[model samples]
Target: MIFFYIFLLLFPHQICQAEVNSNMEGKLLNDLLKDYNKMSRPVKNLSSPLEVTINIGTFESFDLDEISQTISVLLYITVSWVDKFLTWNPEEYSGINQTRLPAGQIWIPDLQLQHTPIGSGMLSTESNAILDSSGLVKHTPPGTIKTICQEMDLYKFPYDTQTCTIEHLSFTHPSNELFLRLGDFTLDQNTFQSQEWQLLNVTSRIEINYYGGPYPFQKHIICLMVKRIPNYYISNMIYPYAVLASVAGLGFTLPPDSADKLSLGVSVLLSTTFYAGMVADIVPVTTSMPFLGLYCLVMMSLVAFSVVSTLAVINLHNRGEAKMSYLQKTIFLKFLPSLLFMEKKSKPSQVQRNTNHKGKVQVETLNDSSKEVEQEQAKDWKFAAKVLNEFCMIIFSAGFFIIFAYTIFFL
Candidate 1:
């Protein structure tokens, strides 16, 4: 009998609490939907300046195409606004905090990028919008956009800087009807850094223009300045070329008479062609070559010149006295040696014995004297060839140094 009385008392209390909760939820929904006819046009707030705020949620990637001169960026674009008709008082509704409603249930501004090549239409999503008690609505849509990037300067290539922009405006609404202002910041600075590019900064600009008419058009442009990270090119393109250039110089140190000198120079020339092709694959095909490409070209020219000089040295080594000219002898043996700072051992002059029994002197025949002079001339020619090799080494070494220094600091 006592248990039956306790159950009846508790049943009424639970029923009353359920009834109050149900009424609060019903009243909140009824009030929120009273003026929320989605099909009805709200003329009262057409001039209320639908304050739009944009933010980035996730920046996936940014790719640049040199041939087309375009940049493509993948981003999660968030557009927020306040819907005056979607408000409800949380205190009056028993703290019925917020609601998730279909985007078709409310008015949304038609926003689009001005000159975007992709993702230019309405942002369609199966996701719902968050409607708070304060009437604020936030929706994030993921999209990819391809836009023009005419500021890619490849003269420095691999170390170049480029600025790309994204512009947006109301597709259907004019400045008087609707206005878009930048949010607190343009991009999500924490996650905008790219793997291959260092993002410098993002700046926003707004322009209002009227073509001698009553209505004005507003445009919002966001410019992104980015510099490429060149560590990949440095390791694969630059350092390898430097190593090859130094290796080509090693040919000069080899003996001029050896057959390997010409072979080494020719091998380096062929190897440079391979690297040049690799670089050509990466760089844009145009009339102007980058500084790194020029350095490669100059290095190849130097190696080819070294090969030609080696052939001349071999010819000089094999030349007979009859074939060798007097001018060649004077220039290579005297002038060139002095100019190149080379020292040659001087042969002792002929000393005739004058210890005769009765005041007599001894003289060698012309044929014997001519042979000795020819031998000394041959030795001088060989010495000059070696000096020529050393001179080329110095010239090529200096050329390499100048090319590298200029490309590094001047260009």
Candidate 2:
């Protein structure tokens, strides 16, 4: 019985409270909207400009199109401005401090994107604007922003960092009536929405533009800095090319008479050509060559030279076992062998040995025929060809390394 009595007592109080709350909200809305003009700007003075602030809360989605040189982002945007005509006394209506109203019925800032081709850069969509008793209106609007970033720095290509900016300019209103600026545009941890790009930072700045208005207009510039993840290029393009270069260098170690030496270099050269075209297709047409592209070109050149050197070495080795000239003996036989850490084996001595046949004292002086001496001093093209192959290997390998380092650092 006590519980039943308590319920009956609270029921009437709850009903009265609900009616009071409803009446308070309805009366507040009615009083505020009675004289509100949605088409006119909320500023009371014509000379005082209405300061509007737009802040990027978060990026729901982000994408970059390399071919088109465009970037698309779906951002959670917050717009804030103070309406001088929307103010009221919070003490008059049950101490109500804030309320929400339809955003389409309020005066919104007229801002358009300078680089976008879509319909006017209106961020305000079907949403509610929170109105405080102090005349502060805060609206959170939704839209996908597409902007062109023409000056994309592709010098580094796959390992490149790109910064794209979206400019928001006031179209209809001059700086005297309305001005727009950026709030805290820092991105949160969830800003990384693109698989190929990493969001490093989001920055914004406001500048007064003087293009079309008697008064200077305000423009809010939003800069998004992102770095490309190079894992894909490293795995598919760079690693394979590095392996191919090593294989081509190993071809020098093969004997000049082996058929695989020249063929190996040719194969590597072909592979390098294919990879260079692949890298060219991966990046858009830019004003300057990418570092990786230059690297590929250098590798291609080195591989081609290696093939030519291998062919020459093979030809020299198989030139009918021809005898080497004096210059060839001096350079390839002596100097080159010393320079390339190769040592030539000498012919065995054919001097006669004294035989003690009858236990008689017999001594024989050493003597060598002219033909034997000439044969001992003879050198062939085969050993010279081997030395040339070693020299080519060292040179081409060093060229590959030098070009790789130059492109990596000096692009």
Candidate 3:
């Protein structure tokens, strides 16, 4: 019963105090806006332009559409200027030194992107701004900005860096009427990280409009330097092609006498073609080819070539005795085989003398007209086929390493 009486006694006192505080704020607001013109410029001196300092607080969402060549950013920016006409005495208004008001009630500069569509304004509308008794007005407006950027360089994609730009310019006002300056750009640590792209650095500057004509329009440009995070592409696209190419190259080392050599080449070739198709579906459709796409296409072609080379090797292996040309003998049979550490097989010699039955001595002579000479020719043909197989292995191996190495380190 005592606590209920105490609550009843405090209710009227609380209502009276609330009413007094409300009246004080009401009088302060009314006195500040008395005879004030919202549309008029806040400049007390007509000899100089009003200087507005804009500070970029943070960037939340950064999206770069490479296909469209545009960058869209969500900006949290604060613009502040001294409004000379909005000043008031804080002591007369119950020490109310600060207040909030809708931004549409005051005069704000008209801003638009330099590369955006004409007549499309960029400023946010009707947001609340904090006003101080000393005539300082600060407005933080959240807005989405989409602007054209430089052409994306995709030749070194998966290891490429792109520079994109966004410029905010004064649309309706010239440099003499309203001066604009950039304060600083702060990148929050959590928001700067992207899954596919990493923020490398940022640069900002103020430049005069090139198409401003005789009137000078000012612009604040912020350029973002971002690099591609290549881990995803390496795992999904490049690494698999490398492993598939190794499988195809091994077909050249397979023995030509068996069907497994042809089978392996055909299977790997088909697999490469299918995999390349999958990669093409996911990659951006562009007139010029990206480095990764080009690498994949070349790998598919090499796999197909391996299949053809294996067929020729199989055909060359199953041949009968035939004479080799001078070029074939000197180059394929001797010099090239020696470079591959393959020496030509020596011709077998027939027994010159033999003992006959009953322990009696008998003589037999070897001659060039003997049947062994034809057998030796057959052996030479087979040896030459072995040399060609080794040669193809080297060629396929060289091709794989050269393209893969360049893609990894250089491109």
Candidate 4:
């Protein structure tokens, strides 16, 4: 009976041990199955089949200078890709064998790229191409491992390349507009549409920078640098002022003897003043005066001289009883007569005349021939004055018209 009790205890312990062994074996088998499944799983394989194309469009220059040329270009880029998964056991999984992944299934987040001219010179061969590095490329798929369908780059690209064909290169002087052509490109045999690009308006100033190098054989180095300068169409505002000033200056040539001299001077001065005010309204007050300002100033000086000269001429003419200096006599008698075509005539004879009181007094009477000659002299002076006045007016009018016409049409 005691032996039977011992056997029961030993049997229970053996059963417990068997159960433990079975549990361990089952766990080990499960672990092995899990590892095998992991090893046999299909592996994701991603590849990018790159088809690159560049479509360079027409270049437009908004502004340009001697040293640097600002240009713009349209770049068309198309990117595509393929996503595939390697099947570990295609025979085991019919779905895996049948499934075909679409093209461009893999995503490329973004493309960061740059273009540099392939030349030795410091000046970039590309006149108008500039690229911004920040956020250059953006893919449609939002998440990690997102599927990529297709990518495209459509915008202006700044750069010049020898490999690219230039089309429609043209330049307009003074306007500073330049046009150039870059190469055309296509993706996957697709037709590329032409693009038009306009560059930024730029005004540049160039300067030479010189450097002296150390060593006896070293040569002086010179480098050209360009800086952008801001500009405006101030010429338009200045031209009108210049024209008005030139027209006003014509008033100076009018005859000094006329009563209209002061009137004309005042009228011209007021007119020019109005024009100057108009010019000031349009242009900013800067330290440096423009070319038009110089012209106006010169006109003002001439007008002032005309006023003084007119006063002097009137003073000389009115001083009739005043004894004239030799210089004055020479100018009035010799020079004036020659210039005005006043010819000298024979003197009248002296004659005797009787008064009402019966006393005879000797009186001088001009003979008929001498009287006729005196009248002719007076007529000649009047005619000469009229002719001189008309001549001056014609000249002034012609000059004023010319200046006005130029300002209106050509300036």
Candidate 5:
């Protein structure tokens, strides 16, 4: 009986020892699984050292207004990825440790990504995704993967920097507005709502390449889009037009008797005409009138006035008769003379008498010499007329050439 009891006690001890060994093994396996889960977690470290490259593609612009004040841009981006290094491996684990480890997986979750402009301007778009397209993967495990993100936004400026250059910027007179769309990892959809965005200044498209995996085992391509905002100066449509019209209006200030009137008027007219043609050449012809067109028309009217006034002055001098008619003697001679002397003279009697006699002599001399002076003035006027005619011819020729060249080349 003592022998049987000893046997039973030894068997219980062995069973207990076996259970303790099993428990220890379970604990070790659990620890290894915890480590694997920690290592396989996705993209928690953005600032981790990475190998990256970027390439940009063609950009296109669209006008949303008649004046070309508002515009939109389309851009293409291409990115390439290289080899990447991963730190932890599921294959390294053995036996029960493998079962305990969470499924070997890595994924980026809830990534708050944005393409920020380091230079200047605000993007005019909703922070949403529009199109997300990916290309085919080449290699097998831990291979190259490329991702494309697209977005549209409005931009405005006083640019903060001048480092990067964007191609195909469109602009027009009176308003300088711009539009653009860009993206990196996320896509923007229905972002072009008018009420949500204001005018923009500039736009940028960018591309980024990512290298990941065990020191050098994977590659990825990321595309980024950016748009810049600009501050705009708003004024009346008539302000610029009025300023140009006033340049032609200066011809009216010339004295009627001055021989330079015709030359001055013709010169002003030609210059204004050239400016008008320049404006016309740059803009498309439309049924609707432009502020610049209004300005040119106003200037032409003033030129017409100058031409008529010159003709009238010449006609009046050509009729060189000084025989004081009732109208001329009564109104011009008598009334004009009385008006000048109505105020008392601040001079001695002798000086006053001399002044009166001088006035009489001057009037008589004017009557005698009027025809000769008229003939001399007429010659000066004729020279002016010839100069004006020549100027008009030159202007016409220049305008014709400009029109012809524009049609042949630009049109």
Candidate 6:
């Protein structure tokens, strides 16, 4: 008897379920549908506009295609409206509070994105609507759509901020019939995160405009402002350029007599042009050049300057003492060396001897020996070449530093 009582205590709910009718849910659905169908046109016949509130459920993906200047996104959209006819008191319906029905069975707002990119159709998944006791109908539909919005100001490209808009409108219904508005918040905070982008903010507004059609329409535009995460760009784009710039700067320090000095400069210039082509392919083809592009041009110009300066130094080094002009000796040997803070080459010690009354010998040190001074003067071309190398190193170093600092720190 105790065993029987224990089994009954554990299995009472299962036994009761077997006795209940399986058709209760179906009966409730049938009753709800019958009442829902009786209300003619659900609020279309009413004088007041139907206020539809929309919220984004999930921001699945956001991508910017720089070449095409388009943004592709995958979004889960939620739209809610109050339908007076679709209501039923939960007390009257066997404790049934809410139910899910096929979306086709209910009247839905014909909302769609108007500025989608070409060849990219609006994709909507088969979804359902939730009908509550107080007649609140909520439908969340998932869509993967590409939008066409151009980001022209790419001056800070690879570190740029872009705003892409998703504009929605009712296709067949006019503004009087369907009024659209944003919900409390446009994006779901928990689901709105990106890997390559920082989702800055989302703004929403409604605009009434006529699209050359008979009736004017209302558009709900949701603008997403995002800044690109620069980690990838820094490593792949700017870092390599920095390394190449350093190599180009090193050319200024190489001896002018080196056979490879000019060759090195030419190689660096060609490399910059190649990188520019790559950047052109990635960024939008616009008349306004970006800072990165300007950086490339400036670097290439400096490299060309280095090459030309190398040639001039080589010519100066090859000129004989008899052929060297007075201006060349003054500028390249005296003024240029002083301007560049180059130390003069070492010279041999000068000796001066004096004989006194007791035949004592004394020696005094002059500045330098006359022979050594003359020899140093004879090698004016060598001194000039050294001056050129030092001068270029100082000037190009400053130029490279200023350009890099301004572009990186200010921008």
Clashes of each: 0, 0, 0, 7, 33, 0
lDDT of 5 by residue, 132-245 (tens): 112111111121111112221111111111122233111110011111123243233333333213323333443322233222222122322333222221122223333443
In model 4, residue pairs whose N, Cα or C atoms come closer than 3 Å (at least 3 residues apart or on different chains), thus clashing, are: 71-128, 73-157, 126-160, 129-158, 129-159, 130-158, 167-181
TM-score, structure 2 vs. true = 0.78
lDDT of 2 by residue, 193-306 (tens): 777888888878888878855788888888889898878877787667777887888899988878788889988898888888888776788789887777777778888888
In candidate 6, stretches whose alpha carbon ends up further than 4 angstroms from where it belongs are 1-22, 27-41, 44-47, 58-60, 84-93, 118-125, 186-190, 212-216, 325-338, 341-378
Choose 4 or 5, whichever is better by TM-score. 4
lDDT of each: 0.74, 0.81, 0.79, 0.35, 0.35, 0.75
Ranking by lDDT: 2, 3, 6, 1, 5, 4
Could you tell me the lDDT of residue 313 within candidate 1?
78
- Models 1 onward score TM values of 0.76, 0.78, 0.82, 0.33, 0.29, 0.77
**Which stretches of model 3 miss by more than 4 angstroms?**
1-47, 84-87, 91-93, 116-121, 278-289, 321-323, 351-378, 406-411
Let me know the TM-score candidate 6 reaches against the reference structure.
Answer: 0.77
Q: Tell me how far the alpha carbon of residue 291 in candidate 4 is from the true structure, in angstroms, after superposition.
A: 5.0
Model 6 lDDT tens row, 245-361: 779778867776688888887888888778878877777777788777887777777777777777877876666443457998788878988887776676555577899999999
- Best model per TM-score: 3
Q: What CA RMSD would you report for each candidate?
A: 5.6, 5.2, 3.8, 21.9, 20.7, 6.2
* Winning candidate number (lDDT): 2
Looking at model 2, the pairs that clash are: none
* lDDT by residue for model 3 (295-380), tens: 99889888888888888777667666566679878876789788999887585556566677788776666666747666777677
**Which residue pairs in model 1 clash with each other?**
none
Could you give the candidate ranking by TM-score, starting with the highest?
Answer: 3, 2, 6, 1, 4, 5
RMSD of 2: 5.2
